[model samples]
Target: MSAMNKKRTESTETLKKVLRFIGRYRILLVVSIVLAAASVLLQLYVPILFGNAIDQIIAEQKVNFSQMWRWLRQVLLVVLFSGAASWIMNLINNRIAYRTVQDIRAKAIRHIQKLSLSYLDSHSTGDIISRITADADILSDGLLLGFTQLFSGIVTIIGTLVFMFSRNVVITIMVIVLTPLSFFVAKFISSHSFQMFQRQSSARGQQTALIEEMIGNQKLVQAFGYQDKASERFARINEELRESSQQAVFYSSLTNPSTRFVNNVIYAGVALAGAFLIPGGALTVGGLSVMLAYANQYMKPFNDISSVITELQNALACAARIFALLEEKPESPDPSESLSDVKGSVEIDQVSFRYTPHRPLIENFNLKAEPGRRIALVGPTGCGKTTFINLLMRFYDVNSGTISVDGKPVDQISRHSLRSSYGMVLQDTWIKNGTVRENITIGKPDASEDEIIQAAKMSHSWEFIRRLPDRLDTVITEDSLSQGQKQLLCITRVMLCLPPMLILDEATSSIDTRTEMLIQEAFDRLMQGRTSFIVAHRLSTIRNADEILVMKDGSIIEQGTHDELMKKGGFYHTLYNSQFVNTAE
Candidate 1:
């Protein structure tokens, strides 16, 4: 109901999510805590043994070698066992923390794969990457520190308090009275630092996105001579990041020293109280020494926990962002109806769609392509050419429409199966860092070597491939190949599949005129007897299409064969003539 209550609720939810990961590895976590407790208990016994040795020497009124030797042996054994347990606990904690974070990272990646294209289009790639890599790393580090210190710190504090109370109740009460000072200081500082840490994490994601954008478009920036402008823009973002980071670190940094200062004051009060008790015959000299030791031990956990709380706040902020991304709803559920015997007869019935609700892009659009027909979509730049293709692929669902293949509704089929039926080549090519052969065979992974080579030859890509060192096996980076070469590889990929339907969205836009002609010939062969949809800016490329649809403002203004539309001198004729006249000039 209130702001404070809302904040508390959100924090509790985030903490629960983080604890779920720990709970998944609960067995290992429990073992780690047990080992840490044993280690702290052994460590706490050493001070008592030392105090007994002091009291033995005082009672004997001389150096007692036998008692001194026994106490020395006990103390040494305790130290040895405590160190071993601490080491084992650390190893177990490391395994639990790393494995848990690894599982979380894996789940995030798999979830991203299932997300719809709309989500990807709206979010920055760099921000997503930061969440998976950098944010996950922060969480892992924080968990490791927390697991290593949390159980042991609590155990040490409790054990030390018990030892202090047994030796001197008066002094123990004094220590208890001052303990809350350190805790209050830690709590006050941490609450103020939490929001600052969250802001820093967000700013870091923004900076990462900006860096990715700049690096991805470095060539364009250089070609346009906008390096200085780009640098200035980056400088502005960097300044914001700096300010946020400084503020966050500044606030969190206060927690440790502030708590330490309070603990020091508590230690001083305990020593002063011990002096008064020793003067009264209520406390012995050895008892006072043990009390001082217990007092220091009791305050140590507070300081350790206060420092860890700062780091935990940062980790919580990162975890909250990561969980938000994971919580996004994936694509709509696939229907039970399977797509069988796809014949590539696509039908769009009264489809209406838009990226936003208020501004409609494609309204009441309809098209029908019979089996084996090649449909050409020609339109101005802003016309819904690509949007139409996106809907057909179900990359984005249409607002009001039914797209069917062979009378089967597209929505009824699984997205994977529906997309598998179509072979696509776009003007923008994506090639990973791999061998040329591997890149070409991506669409059809099981294609025989001969089939791969044949597809490459048909697409006119083999000519350049043969010239490369190792030919098809040659590894190629993104910058190693020319634009036309990349386009040919993409076309070759599509050809290897030989799917039932084809969609070429300006597939030849990047190639030279001669290369375009050769690729078009390959496409013609590839499209034979299979329905094809071609979106081309070069009007000449689609002259032989079975049907041409002239589009404007998201609606088809004219539709007919090339010669039939040319004879009518309608929108198609005007578009064709303008391109022809521009080429002539």
Candidate 2:
């Protein structure tokens, strides 16, 4: 296909997709269209009442109040009816358009949740946020404005054409010649504005990302004296948006005036032509008056057409971005078939992964564990410990490896069911603003009060809960609790869920010594029957762990018990004695 044909075909497909997104709203859409048409037809007719009044009195020399009263009544009725129809049109259009936008947002949120780890790794949170929120708003505004104006413009143009041709064909034809010129104006403006508007939208998204980063890390910015740097970048993005938007506005601004200028020149030429007809007894004064009214009204539809065409380009740009997100491939293929009784057993063989294609973080890694085996993974920062747990959870798929639970391939199981088998507590855990009871027992909402308290006690969070004025009903959150308290509650949440397998990724790095010992006791209680993978930086916490794997550069360099590693005189022995053994002495 030729390049232009290819572009048109792609645009047609995009429009088809947008209409598909508006599925099931056909009834409301049809009704809105009909009401809008009725409103426009009535509005167009009401203006013709003046022409009738002038012709009745001026041309026929008849002074009749009944004729005038009749015309006045009809005009009032048309105005009232049009007003009612316009109201109905607006209500129905707003309802359906907003509903469609709401559905888009909800669907995008669900789709993002199902998307694979690689997809999220490729885009930032800010980019996705702008798509679901800002871009959807752009679509809604453009669609409603374009659809309503396009319909109203069409009706007005049709009415104007009928009236003008009925009065005098020669003058009407002279004016109609300028219609093609209006089209040229619209076409020129839309083409010039499309790419500029697209750039502005992109710049807006970048600005959103920068502002979000600033808000999320105000403390870091202050500590590093990076406010000036952050502000400079933000200003640059802001100016980029301003420049693109200004350019798009300037290009489109020509469309209206160019159209109106051509229209005015046509009007002057038509008036002169009509004057010749009037002297030759072909047209009267009333006829000339009526012609001008019809001619002026006819220009309105074309004016609106020009305006709506510009908005159409904007909607098209937003639709392309939205569809791009919708077309992204999600993480894993979720199974429609359900599997039950997922055992906590996990095994990884020959697994390799990297957050990016250029860097390989985990290579040829292998591990094995069954029910009731607690393995402690000890490694320095950035040593693939968290990546290991992420793989087991199937948050990410391995580039070349096999990881499974109960002999079922992780890819073959539904993501929901696969994730339900394990619970997690991380060092930098998030505690939403809610009561203590809500965070725990999140998996099982129907868990009884007794079960909630039991989970809290097992995680050693009960002591802090007892101190709260409301106990389980206390509104617990990071703002309300200390670091130790938040960790305790996070552990309590894991305990409440009672998953067969648990992952603690540096889960106890924040507590003081007194609370740390209590938390360790709680950890032992929580791990009584559950198989656990513990990622810990503090060597003392994993001293009694059943198996300890010492990792370096994503590979296990050594594996043994605490006493066994201390006797090996290897990397573990040197590191342990330097960091922990000497402190103990």
Candidate 3:
């Protein structure tokens, strides 16, 4: 109903999420808390020791040297034990902080893997990475600070109050009267700052996404002479991020000073109260000294806690982003049935789908491929060519109708089995940062040396592979190879598996003509006795395909062999002639 109430509710939810992560290390947390309390209590006892020693040495000549030595020794042991406890507490806190962060990041990655492809297609990769990396790091910092300061501050506050009450009730009451002011100040500032911190985190994610997009496509930006526009866009996002961050920081930063002012007032009250009590014989000089020490210790926790609250607000904001990602609904569960020994018979009956319900991309798409049949899909960009392939692979479920493999619906089979049965090579190549052997053997990890070499040679990638420093063992990255080389490796990966079905999406678009011919020959040999779907933009590439389906705006306009379509003079015929006509120009 109110802003403060809403802020409290959000913070509590975020805190509960954090506590679930922390709850995994319950034993370690308990040990850390015990050590923190022990350390604070020991430190509180030191002030009493100082008061005793001070009272004993009222005069320098009459000072009890033996008595002082004993007290000094006890003080030394207390300090040593307190330092040890604090050090160990810090070590355990570090372990918990880092390990909790590790769990959150790992869970985020695992959840991302389970998410539907549609979700990933709609979201930015850079933003996901920022939440897992940068946001998680901030959470780790907050956890570490909370463990180190929050626990110790609470213990110090409680212990100081107990010690002060045993010495003088009047001074203790005076200190207690001013304590609420610090909490009120912290709560007021934190309430206003929480929303700003949330805004800052979202802006940070946007900036990360923009940077990733620009850097990832730097060549495209430069080639199109759009660098100035890109820079301007980045500047706008950067300015937004700066303004949000500045406001959040400015609001949170007020907590420390405002609370410190209240703490000082409390301290001044203690000093004045103790000073008046000494004249009435209600307190001794040693008692006054102890009261002053307790007052400082009491106020120190409030100051430290106010700062912790500020950090907690920022940390919770980041945690909320990460949690939002984790909360996304995962893909529906697959049936218990698993496809095995796939015969490559695919049937798409009345299949209809769209990214958005308002705009149809594929409607009533129907296709049936018997074993060893090759189906070619040809269309302009955004005509549902790739979307069809995505549906076939079960990347996205159809909005209507059934897609079956070997008489069983795709949804009835495990996704892992359905996907693994098909060998796919797309134009957009992906090469993980690893060795040449690793990349080639990704589809079939246990592939032998001979099998890997044979696949590489078949794909025509062995020519470049043999030239590398370590051949199969050479550590290579995506940037280390040319585009064509990367595509060749992707082709080799599929070639190694030689699955029951195949999908070639402009597989040779990046290779030169000579290499393309060789790879095409290899593909011909590989496609034998295997059902295949090819999405080709170059009309000439699909001339030999068994059945070419011409698609336009989510509908198949024509379907026939190249000669049949050419004789009929349909859309395929026009599209076929247009390519040669453009080349002639």
Candidate 4:
């Protein structure tokens, strides 16, 4: 197909997605429909009053004052009522549109929560936020304007035309001759507006990204003295946005004045022709008056048509983006593979994983651990220490091989359930701006106060917590925390979770040696009954583990008890000799 056809097809698909968003607001939408119809109905009566006022005096020769008063009062009443109804309809539409946007925000936020880590890694938070908030808002406003006004205006135009033709066909034909010009102008403007609006939406997203970057890295700007650089970047994006917005406005802005200009020309021409026809007894004065009124009515819908078409274009772009997001395939279907309990036992069998297809990390790796084992994975940097935890958690699927928790395949078990069974601690702690208790209970929302304190004690975090004014209820954030203290809070959260399996991926890498020792004691308490995987390069930390494995290039080359590995005269022996024994001696 040609490019134009493809564009049209894509626009239609976007409209369908937008319609689905509107489906939930059907009741309010229907009310909008009723009010629009009522507005048109009341509005349709004024022209008839003008025709009647002329017909009774000129055609029927009855100059009845009481009838004339009644007709004028009826026209005034319709005008007042139509104005009130239009105002109410606009109020309802604004409410409906605003509420629809709120729902979209809610849905997008929920979807973001469920997205996997891999997805978040591939996309920036600012971009995701723009899609939810700014993009969704554009869709709401654009659709609300396009749908409600387009519906009322088009209907009103048609009704007025029909009323005009029934009263006088000559003036109607004049309008009919001029109708093609109105549509031609509207179509031309709309087509240009479509392209301009695409640019407008693109610019809006770009502007949002720039603002987000500046906000997220304000400190970096100060640190690097990049205020001038940041200002230049922002100004460039702002100018681009302004240009695109002007183009969109220019196209839509042309439709109204151009339509009115054409109407004024047509009205003047028709009135002159009608004046000649009236002397020749071709048209009654009342019929000419009503036809002129309808001609004005006709120009309005066409004028609105131009604006609606432009808005539809913007809405189409937003709808397509939103639909594309909504249609994204969520993390692969995770089926239940583990029938029996986990029993805190795990084994990796000839497993290999690659972050990217070409960048093979772990190759043909195999390891086995007993129930309730405390295994430490030690290796130089760039080894597959962290990758192993990723596999066990199923954050990234293994390239080839099977991992099992309790002899059942990892992929076979539901990802949710598998993850739920394990407690993980990360190197960089994430402490939200909330009370200490709120952070701990985030892992287990209903964890009792005693349980929280008990877990905190196991992580050796309660010692610091007890010093706070409100203890558990005291707020702890970046504003209130030193790095080491924050790490303790994260550990406190993990301890409260107390899953059957624990994976600590450099969880204590940031803490001071003294705090590390205290944390290790707490971790030892926490690890007593569960199987734990500890990935650390520091030899002092792994000395007490039941088993120590030295990993390199994603595979385990040496594994044994600490003393046993030292006696083997292998990789583990070298790692131990280079770090621990040398430091001890």
Candidate 5:
């Protein structure tokens, strides 16, 4: 197929998707259509009233006060009703359009929440946000304008054409001949402009992603003195966006003027034709005037439609992006088997995995932790310590192995139940803009005020919490608290839950050494009678762990207590010595 044909097909599909949302609010849509038709009918008849008043004046050779007065009142009443109907229609359109878009946004967000971690890890945060907010808004605005203009424009064009046919067929024929010229111009420009608008939309998303990334990591950028590099990178993307936007606007902008030019030519033809007919008694002055008015009304709809079409192209492009996100496969279905009466005895058997097919990351890893054991995974960076934890958490499934907790394969258990059995505190903390109590109680919402305070105190977070302006109720803005405070809040959240299993991935990395000791003491109490896996680069933290598994390149090279591993004088010995040696120097 030709490029235009391909675009037309895609546009039709996008339009169908948009109409599905409209179909959801069909009742409001029907009412809006009725109002629009009523407005168009009322407006269409006003020109007839004007023609009658003109003929009465001409026939009397003076102002026919009674006839003209009656015509004036009819025209005024029509104008008033038309304006009221149009206003009501607009109000209904806005309600229906906005409500439908709101529903779409909600559904998209819910789907995003259910998406697998793998999917999220592979996508950019800013792009996903842009699709949900910016692109969705564009679709909403476009639908609103399209619906408002589409019904009225079509009704006006058809109603005016009917009136013109009744008054004079010759002038109507002239109009019929010229109408296609306007449509052709609109179609030609829109076809090319659609691709440009799509490009512009993509560029805008890229720019938004860059801005979100830079702003989110502004501290890092500034700290590293890479502000100029960030600015230059942003400038390049911004320039591309500007060029795409300019091209898209330039082409779509041609639609209105080009259609208007055709309408003007058709109007000139109508005037010329009406002049010859007036002398032959084929047309009265009033009839000629009504025909000209009808001609203007008929052509005006084309201009309105053309503009709507151009805007719709941009909206459809954005809709396509949003729908693409919604179409992603959600998390795998949950199994009927579930963990119950959980005692955290995690066992990894002959596990083999790879992020990519050809390059192996984890190979035949094996381990067993009895209930309530503190198993520390110590390894050099990229030696699969974190990857092992990810497997146990079931964030990524192993290629060939079974990770079981309490004699049940992880895959056999429902993800919700499996994940709820563990309380995790990672090195990177996630704190939302909410009250301090809310952030701490997120893991266990039913936690009472006293319970929340107790958890905070146990995690060494209550000292700072009590000093805040509102204490526990103080809202935590993004920049309101320090990184260590955020990590403390995360740990406090874990303490409140008190799950059967715990995973701490460098949980105290952000805290100062003094606070770390206090938090460590608190964690010592918290880890009692729970299976805990601690992943830490600081070997000092896990020296007293029950069993320290020294990992190297996806396999366990050593497994014993901290002293036993150090006495063996191998990879763990070297790793431990290097850390303390660095500290001593």
Candidate 6:
């Protein structure tokens, strides 16, 4: 199919989706439609009243004052009623428009929660935010305009046609012949502008993504002297956005004026026809007045519609992006069965996985961790140590073979139940905007104040917490606390829960040496009766671990206690000595 046809098809589908959302408030929509129609019909009757009063004044000496007064009063009543109906219609339209926007935003947020980590990792945060906020607002504007203006415009056009035919069919035929010109003008302009509007929306998303990136990492940008480069990149995107927006607005702006010109021709044609017929006495002066009025009314809707076509196109483009997000495939669903008695006995048998099939990352990886065993994973970067942790937590599943906890395959258990059985503390700590108490109680919300304090004390964070002005109630944001404090808070969460299994990926990387030793002592007590997997780069930290697995190129090259590995003088011995050599230097 042609490009125009493809766009038309996509637009039709997007319109259908929009209608379905509006359908949720079908009762209110119907009321708005009825009021719009009533308003237009009442307004249409005013011209006929004026026309009748005009005929009453055929001659100054032959004027009927009482009859003209009655017609004039009726016209006043019609105008008042039309205005009232129009007001109520607009109120209902506002309600529908805002509520639909709310629903769409809520749906997008809920869908984002269900999406897989891979999908979110691949998409830009700013683009997703733009789709939810900016796009939804644009759609709200379009819906409001469509409901308030489009409905009444259509009714006004049809009502005028009926009124005009009743007065003088000959002149009505002339108006009808010229009416299509207005529609043709609107259609031609809108068709070309739609593509430009789509381009504008895309560029706007890219600009948002870049702004978000720069704002979130401003320190890095300054430290690396990337301000000039970032600004240059932004300028390029901004220029593209400006060009697309200029072209879109230029084309869409033509619709109103072009349609208005056609409407004027139609109006002039009606007047000329009416003038010729009046001399023949086939039409009265009042009849001619009514026909001219109807002619203007007939073309008014086309003008109104043409003016709003810009918003309609923009709204459709935004809706398409939101729907694309909603269409993303979520993570695989879990089974109904949940893990009931998690003993932390994890076993990986012949597990093989790769992020990209062409480049293997983890192949035939196998391990068995008995209950209460401390397994330390030491490896160079890019050796799949973190990937292995992700597999155990079921963040990413293995490509082949079974990974089981307590003899039950991880895939066979419900994700919520399986994940809750383990406590994880990673190198990158996340602190939300909340009070210290609230952030610490995330793992176990029902924990008492005493329990919260005990966990904080165990994690070596209570001393710092007590120093704050508000203690545990102090609201903290991402930037409110130092990196070490944030890591302590994250560790506090694990201490509070104390799940059967633990995964610590350089959990103390941000803390000072003294705090690290203190937290490590607490961690030792915490791991006394739990199975734990620790991924560490500092070989000295894992010296006392029950077993150390030295990894290279995604495979384990050495597995033994620190003393046994050192006795062998293999890969682990060299790695351990290298770390100590760097520390001494």
Question: How well is each residue in 177-262 modelled by candidate 1, as lDDT tens digits?
Answer: 88998899888887767677777888888889988998999999899998999889889878988998899898888888888888
Tens digit per residue, CA lDDT, model 5, 1-585 = 998789788888988987897799899889998999999999999989999988887645577779988998999999999999999999999998899789889989999988877789888889899988988899988989998998999999988888888888878988998899999999889888888888888988888899999998988999999999999999999999999999999999999999999999999999999999999999989888998889999999999999999999999999988888888999777898889989999999999998878988899999999999999998888999998888888888889989999999999999889998999999988998999988888879888999998998899999899999999999988688998999999999999999999999999999999999999998999899999999999999998799999888889989999889888999899998998899999
Q: Highest lDDT, which number?
A: 3
lDDT of 4 by residue, 142-254 (tens): 87897678879878877877887787777778888877787888777776666677777767777787778888688888999999998998899789889988988877888
TM of each candidate vs. truth: 0.97, 0.93, 0.98, 0.89, 0.96, 0.98
Per-residue lDDT of 477 in model 4: 77
> What's model 4's lDDT at 455?
85
* Reference-based TM-score, model 2: 0.93
Q: Weakest 10 consecutive residues, lDDT, candidate 5? A: 56-65
Candidate 2 lDDT, 427-530, residue by residue in tens = 99788888888877678899999998888887778988988898888886667788778888888888788888888888888777887787788778778777
- Tell me the lDDT of candidate 3: 0.92
Candidate 5: list runs displaced more than 4 Å.
1-4
Candidate 6, overall lDDT?
0.91
Worst ten in a row by lDDT for model 1: 3-12
Cα lDDT of model 6 by residue, 1-585, tens digit: 999999988888988988998899999999999999999999999989999999999686999999999999999999999999999999999999999989988988998987877788888999999899888888899889988889999889888888888888888888888788889889888878778888988899999999999999999999999999999999999999999999999889999999998889888888888889998898999988888888888888899988777679888888888888988887788788888777889999999988877989888888999999999999899999999988988888788989999999999998899889999999999998999999999989999999999999999999899999899999999999999999999999999998999999999999999999999999999999899999999888898899999888888889999999999999888888998898899
Q: What do the candidate models score in CA lDDT, each in turn?
A: 0.89, 0.80, 0.92, 0.81, 0.91, 0.91
What is the Cα-based lDDT of residue 356 in candidate 2? 81
Candidate 6 residue spans exceeding 4 A from truth: none
Task: Evaluate residue 410 in candidate 6 and report its C-alpha lDDT on the 0 to 100 scale.
Answer: 94
Evaluated at residue 147, the lDDT of candidate 6 is 88
For residue 239, model 1's alpha carbon misses the true position, in angstroms, by: 1.0
Off by over 4 Å in 2: 1-13, 59-62, 336-343, 476-478, 581-585
In the order shown, the candidates' Cα RMSDs to the true structure are 1.5, 2.6, 1.3, 3.3, 1.8, 1.4
Clashing pairs in 1: none
1-585 per-residue lDDT for model 3 (tens digits): 888788789889999999999999999999999999999999999989888877787675888778777878889999999999999999999999999999999999999989999899999998998999999998999889999999999999999999999998878887888899899989889888879988899999999999999999989999999999999989998999999999999989999999998888888888888888889999888888899999999998888888888898899999999999999999999788888888999999999999998998899989999989899999888999999999999999999999999999999999989999999999999999999999999879999999999999999999999999999999998789999999999999999999999999999999999999988899999999999999999988888889999999999999989999999998888888999999999
Q: Name the 10 consecutive residues with the lowest summed lDDT in model 6.
A: 113-122
